[model samples]
Target: MNCEQIRELLAGYQDGELDGAQHEMVSGHLEECADCRAELAQLDKVKEVTGKVKYNDLPLEVWEGYWQGIYRRIERGLGWIFASVGAVIMLITGAYYLVKDYFMDPAVALFPKIGVGALIIGGGFLLVSVGRERIFAHNRDRYKEVQR
Candidate 1:
């Protein structure tokens, strides 16, 4: 097996999840690859230490307090998100009216100039949004492949 495939299977091999043949293959690879052997040794040490560590249970009041803090943070985060969305809506609405007024004014000789400026700004925003979406999609695809 290749080094990457061996690395990916290391966790399963350590956990005894691999079939006998696959386990043997990984073992063979580890015997030949110093880096993989080092990685496996490190993982084994981590697992051993973690397994030996003791966990403490929180008191009822402490649990409640922990949950309360989490709840408060979530509430604050949601409130901020809503407020940001409202602000964006207001800005867009106000800008729409301003643009409309600029274009409707009969004596304004700079209507075309203002319209062109608005168009350029709007186009730039659209391009940025599209670019961001494409980048997010590409990264998401890569993440899924890695998970597999």
Candidate 2:
């Protein structure tokens, strides 16, 4: 057998899975080929190290608690989302009324009105800047789909 064929059969040979004829063919090739022998030796080392490794399995109670923790996080996240939306709506409504009242009052100075307008414009610019930054960051983020 050629080097490629012998290499392919090396795994099965190491595991003693080959029949009499195939076994003899791979054995003869290994005797003559130093490179294939080296490769087989490397494969044997890998198998030996991996065979000694052990994995720990979690108990059922730990798994149940893990799922419960996830559920609680989801529930809290939804609650916070609702609370934030409500708070933002209330704040916007209050700001609108305050601005409207200021504009309607005869005693209010022109400079204060102008200042409020400038503040609103500045807030708009800040919001847009933050949005653009978030979009750019999202595009560049390598682990965008990876969960927390």
Candidate 3:
């Protein structure tokens, strides 16, 4: 076989993947060609160096930081979720009582009831608008990572 063909199979031959005929052909070429022999030697050195490559590990602080970030995100997310749920439940109950007891009373004057209803509606809209704005700003806050 030519040097190029034999060199192509050199890795396979080194790993004992070549059949007897192929092995003998490569051996014959390596014996006669100094260039092929040099190539085989270089391949052997590369295989040795790569086989000895070791795995490196990150430092303790890196792992600690990773875990801390994860825990903080989970803790804050759950806290906010639980607090919002509780507040919503209380708001619903209070709203129900206000509507049933105050708004439904026949003795209540029309003007006062209309004023209170308008105040509650405006407050609800303001609360929703502020909450949405806060969430939008929080998501896009470019300087949130800046330390004081």
- The prediction achieving the highest lDDT against the true structure is 3
TM-score of each candidate? 0.36, 0.42, 0.55
**Candidates ranked by TM-score, best first?**
3, 2, 1
For candidate 3, the C-alpha RMSD (Å) to the true structure equals 14.7
RMSD of each: 16.1, 12.3, 14.7
Worst 10 residues of 3 by lDDT: 52-61
For model 3, how does the per-residue alpha-carbon lDDT over 44-130 read when each residue is reduced to its tens digit? Answer: 999887765522234566688778978987997899799999989998998999999999998998899999999999999999999
Assess each prediction's global lDDT (C-alpha) against the native: 0.83, 0.83, 0.86
Model 2 agreement with the true structure over 26-127: per-residue lDDT tens digits = 889888889999999999998887765522234666678788878876886798689879978986997789777987787999999889889888987997
Reference-based lDDT, residue 32, model 3: 96
Off by over 4 Å in 1: 54-148
lDDT of 1 by residue, 24-133 (tens): 99999999999999989999998887765532233666688778968976996798689869977987897687668765667778868678778868976997899699
Model 3 error, position 114 (Å): 0.7
Model 2 gets an lDDT of 0.83
Q: How far is candidate 1 from the true structure (C-alpha RMSD, Å)?
A: 16.1
Error of 2 at 117 (Å): 1.3
